[model samples]
Target: MTKKVCLILAVVLMSQASRACDDNKEEELAIQQSDEYFARAYGFTPETWNTLYHKPSSSLQDALDVSPYEGRTLFKRPQSSNNSFKKYFNRDQEDHENHGRFAFAGLGANIVNTGLFNNRYTPANTWRPLITLAKRIPISVNPNFNNPLGSFDPCNSNGGESGICTSGSVCSLFGGRPSGPCDQGQVCCINVINSCGSIVTLNNTYWQTPPTALRSPCTLTVRMDPKFIEQKNNPICQIRLDFVSFTTSQPTAGTCTDTFQVGGVSNEVPTICGDNRGQHMYLHVPLSSNNPTDVQLLFNFASGTTISRSWNIKIAMLPCGATYLAPIDCLQYFTSTRGRVSSFNWQDVAGARQLNNQNYNICFRTELISSQKATRMCMSVCSATDGDAFSITTPPAVLLVASANTGFASAVTTDAMEAAQNSAVGATYTDQSRANGITVATCLYDYLLIPGGRDANNVEADRYCGNKLNPSPGSVKFQNVCTNLFQQRVFISGTDTNVQVCTPIRPFKLTYQTDGQETAVDAVPATNTIQALADVSNTGFCLEFQEN
Candidate 1:
């Protein structure tokens, strides 16, 4: 029995020791699992853990535990690779050292640990292990505030007619009607106020309607609001009164009486009021009224009660000189010169073919129509025969005749013939005679026709001469003398002439015919048919005449 008892005791002692060993193994596994969880949550590696903890592990178990989840770490890693959690740990440790308190670390650790304990036995609580202490750090919150404009009530809903105040939140005036419980930051204005104890401003919509009309012997008064006036920087502002429309019974001027008064002082009224009905008439009146003052408009029909008058007026306050840039009464420049007329006649040989001599004479005389000034003139000639060219000349006999026509004492210089040249139907030639700078308007011109050339082909005669001459058949067609004579005149700057520029003020052309002892002006080669071509080449003259 003694032997059996000893053996039993030995067995019991061994069993107790084995059970103790098993408990130790389970506790070791729990600790290892907890470390793995932290490594996964905070991206801790054995290298990093050693660096942060400042100590090496007893075995490679802590380091080896980090290998199973090399790339599969769940938490975000710190930017630094050497020690991932060192900064966070150091921050917490600093707080504790500085304030003698655990700061966030103690609280976060307790919450995470408690959560882990509660969910430890259950695999269903996947989030428990993932819960991190760092997430417990406080986050700030911000909220938006309101603005002034949003606080006001909408205009239409507050008690006004619907269509008039359709969509705006701000109150406004419409055609002399008031409406709105205006939105914030906007003021309400009235349409028309007879007595303005304060300055009255008409909203934009009020101008849409036509102004009211007042008749003769009637008075209209308006008083400005003092508050509105004071807000303007200029204490002395001007009021612009527009007479939009006016009508009077009488058509004569000075028959109707209408007047305007500002601050009890009568002002000058518009003259010729009846003539400008329906036209815009603006009046500016200066106002120095610090208090509410009357703007009175009075009409007196005392002269004639039968003379009835009516006018539509619009009023606005503006800074001085606002409408001072009024319309100007401008004078027009004189387009033509005033002068007397002078004429002379010449009889010349007419032949179907070229004349026997190479040239024939045509003559004209000029007399001063006005005060003597340098003048520019041009002349053209036309004849039935083509190639009947003419040139101006100062042969002694022709010059003698011209000198007699001018009535000048000494023999006039033949300088007038300088501009003369053989005529071409579509070509322009200037009078070179005026080159010597003749200030006297009186002069004479002589042209010699050299008739050796052949006739110019009549191209589409009907279009040119207003006559159709049949080329064949017994076409006993009478020649229209009017078609034979084409004359043109050119005038350079009249009294104020610029010879260098040679500005042609008025240049015209005419056609004439001599038949049955009668001379009649004919319209041909129409006006502006010949234009002074500008010499862009800048060669001879500033301008030269050319046929278009």
Candidate 2:
């Protein structure tokens, strides 16, 4: 052949060889892509694929590189004799069920290659073998299982139009509505009545004036209302008095022009007259048959130019048999009905008016209902009396002062009772001193509360007497017994027809115990009285007093 003919023949042979090589490469690429799809879809490694294909043992890398579908390609004609397709389908079903029922449905379509690209064998569209992979396989087994909006059905569970009830909106559970806004330790009732855990207040008001007579005294009466008596089923209940206002023109001692007396008929004796102008008065008076009346304010203004006097009173009723856990201060009951009275002037016998600085005189009485003992009594005189002209002329009463070794009935004179008398006279009386007096009286009088008489042969009489007359240091019962002297004089003055001397008493603090295991210190009004009752069974309930 010539050079030109040889060049043309070489180009044609090279072109034919190149075409054959390209077709072989395309076929290999197709086989690789098909192997990869089956490995992933059927959850098999190269080793497992070899075993399923009945191929000889080989290295992992060699088996992966050599496609199982190279000789038996996916594009080849189907064979009924080879049941390997069924095995792949079975394995796919097992994997689908293991992961979840819906996880491998799309995987099944890819492996079977039934629909798209069943006849396509071109290498340009390699992804055509996995067309169903892009068709969207569900991430979860149940399509509606994880839809956030579809998970909760609030309307069905809560009797409402929406899943969550609106604020302040009513909701029903088990066919019942919720109720609230109840008080502490209380529950709201369906009947809509606020009857549980309530505190009730009962109050009444009255006004009175004293008469102008010398022997006959004026009176202000207080009794339980008919309605209250009917409800409580008793004549007497717990009560306190408020001396809202007391105004007297001339409250002087000698002139008897403006004298006043105050006490419970059965529980307390009448107090000596002192200047009570603008002075608040509080009295805890229990009205029983013995003291059938609550209180009496006797006035004797026989000499002053202005004999006018008037008073306003308010009474508070508490529940009967109610236990008071806190200390009750009777003096606090004295509301600011009027201002304080600082001074007054009394006309002398020579007709010359004398300026006398006025001071307060208050009295108090307490009865121990259970102990049946002599009442635990306390008295205080605020502004000192002008003792320069006043004197107790009556013979001193005799009292049995007992000692550990020998008990003697001696005459305890009010004349020598200078502590309370001088304290009141000098206007130097203090709340501390008054408290000391109460402590002594309660201790001493408690000893005198014998069953039969004031004799030494009584049971434990010596011990009781010794404890009262002689007390240890810093003890409540160690104070002087001057309160008894003051009480004697007040009693004498109240009953004495020849003299009408009124001693001045002031408000003082008192310590008392309540039923609830608490010790309370409160100021008791000089005009009021105190009463304590011992428990009958000698239980811890003993030593409780009624608060005014």
Candidate 3:
């Protein structure tokens, strides 16, 4: 404003007769005094301001004083002062609604790309929440709660670990410790949940063992907030628990001493105990739950036992219809086409022991998206060099006797003493050892089922148990190495030398089931407390699959 405008206000209300004329003369005089110096005070207006707003309202001669401007001011142009707020931040225009980055984030929905490809492809996953995100978010609010802002940034830490990316104030608000730096002036907040009975809502949250040793049961609850659920555009389908480091009291004879189990899931997860490092599980989540779902991971330690225990499990929430999503009902899913698959409690401590009463399918990735093609897949046991690697209680060969000399008859002898004398089938042994391979007997209980397994010549195969997964039903002479290399493969469709490891058809899956009745040495009985076979505690199957 010019000094003329300031001086004109001083002469207000002179006399009714000369007031009008006096005011006009005084305003003109004031403009002449300071108009040249302060006229340029408006300065050069930038394009952004010009597009969103108008110029200063008038040229020099119109007024002697200026009116003030405000944010969200209800005053409009032409009606109120020239500098009154427009539609930018003022929002005084009743017809306008909310629309911006900050506004859409609170609405919680997947962005719909109607024009171009979505996931960076020619035609990406064009899955959108509703008809359009813009229509739903404007002037809308979540019915459950208002404050739905949360931080679930999985790509936040080193070594594949994860943390939440949010402001320090939000970190403190959620009782999280601000760690590394994040984009947009935010911090990588990590919420280390060590206490039992604590709820886990953030994806990639870590559940670690308590600092001080306590025999009490530890439990971590999981549930999604409505805001988070909607933002994902689908309900939680599976919860993957990655055991980065896990060690507890090993199972005692098929039963776990210190158990780790999950509840409130649609599918079943085995209760296991032992050293299971670098293993993961895909827990099935229930469909609906009044909006948010609830799942619990529970651990129990048996009392009156001296055993070391520790665990660091990373929890991941997978929404429905997501990329790299595992098949439903699969207990474990291996994404990489080339990786080893281990049992829940299977460890290398005491030779190798398979957990009893385990019934779950382990899936391998067969179909790759985004131009990745892989049709042929194969799984092989530890290897021929490691003789002790294959042990699943396969029945004895009916043709080969303790010695190759006695042929054309059941290798198993009637007298237990006589069988041991010839190293024949049904021979009792103290230590863990392979029994016999390629037997005609059916494997009813405690066996690994590799559906449609075959040998080099495509000979049909069946359930494999009792020691080795021999490729063919050849005599004991062929059991050694140099047995055709082509036979030792379990294919995406077929093939395996000995120890039976198979799958569940398409998508390439293997089912490992163990009935309560294990191989009983005393006549191989199904039920009752019969003596367990000498190979009761033997190395479980350790097979590797490759995608080609």
Candidate 4:
């Protein structure tokens, strides 16, 4: 190749650029992102092709000794990439994302016969034959542009659906329509076989509750095909399941009548039953595994079921070290800084009863990456106190506030006790703790662990468990409705009536804990919270959270 042809070849290679976006995420992961990442590789730039032609080495050197500097071979590096392709792929993952890396020699003298850039456009062809000597292949790799498997590789997003990133000719071969543009003259394909049993290999897929009632044991297994280890370069590190619309039979006491289990993961996801709509969970993928493990979403309905089930769950796959990845130990993760978190099956999910034996952390994002800053979080019972919306008291469904005398760690059932029985305070009293401010420790069986929680007086009341938001003679029912002017109101019949809003500045974290036993207690116990009721079936709390 002559010097003039080299200039023309460099222009052609530069012109080969595809449309790309600067942002990796536009909104929630459900929204199909048009992010096209392009990375300029450091290998075989035009100046590095000088001395490799005359002397093809008996053993390959780190990089082609084209010149001392100016340009360097990409396969090896002056920046210490060693000889392993694994480090190169990890360092520049965006290069092999929706867009594959650009590998070319621009113009080379006798480089074709030396067997590196044999063809004008397919330089990686010669590199393919050399990898077979290894006993085991890498988990993921850069799909050579000329490889036939690239034709069916279901990668990238297209028109709000998971798409196979492939060339136009190859897309047509599989009867897939070219929905959108991908990098490197390829198209995002939208017509692949997607069903419950079929292994989903793409990102951003949707799995809804089966329309038919008979479709029990419905499983949608999301796993990267381990067979094509050479083509998949980006490993999905985390899988976020957005319960866009999830509903099923409520749990019986604490046990699930119908079950939705997450399987094939190394970690154990707690089996949950009942209404989980508007909720999300993060399932992590172990990166060190030679073959990427599968994460299965299984929904098994009880035989001869009566409740109508409907769900629309969106599966979003995130690459390793993605921004949206939740903490490794977190089972349920929320990216939105502000939202309401109702306990499983609260508010009519079994007649508004709290699921028993519950223990899990409800995590919220406090990062400054979003449009809103989660600097401080203010939580109150969901503004819905009309009926039994915010009723997770230890004693069945009622709270008794002493109009006269109330002390810390004392029974708060009052209103003459007869009037409390006549009123809708139920036939029993709830978990009572005049355990005010930071000394709030009367609650043990079921309570929200809010670190640095404070009362309206701005005192450190870091824990809350009794009847209302703070210590108040507020659970008194007036005209058959529990109304507390001293606390924040639910839409009951309601707004915060407190003179001052309590502590809202703490590390945003809350753990909802419910003990295994729900047996009724005749009197308040010195340990494990207080409960005085004929039936101790307490309703779970409904909390509303805000980030800004």
How close is every model to the real structure, measured as TM-score? 0.23, 0.24, 0.58, 0.56
- True lDDT of residue 71, candidate 3: 8
Q: Please name the candidate that would achieve the greatest TM-score relative to the true structure.
A: 3
TM-score of 3: 0.58
Candidate 4 per-residue lDDT over residues 503-537, each given as its tens digit? 45433567777665545443335654444332234
> Which residue pairs clash in candidate 1?
198-225, 198-226, 199-225, 199-226, 359-449, 415-433, 416-433, 419-432
Model 1 segments more than 4 A misplaced: 1-175, 178-216, 224-236, 251-253, 257-272, 278-293, 302-309, 320-548
lDDT of 3 by residue, 464-522 (tens): 55555543433232232123222221101112234333332455667777655334444
Against the true structure, candidate 2 reaches a TM-score of 0.24
Clashes of 3: 23
Residue 523 miss distance in model 4 (angstroms): 11
Tell me how far the alpha carbon of residue 503 in candidate 3 is from the true structure, in angstroms, after superposition: 8.2
Question: lDDT, candidate 3, residue 293?
Answer: 59
RMSD of each: 39.6, 40.7, 22.0, 15.1
Model 4: how far residue 199 lies from native, Å: 2.7
Ranking by lDDT: 3, 4, 2, 1
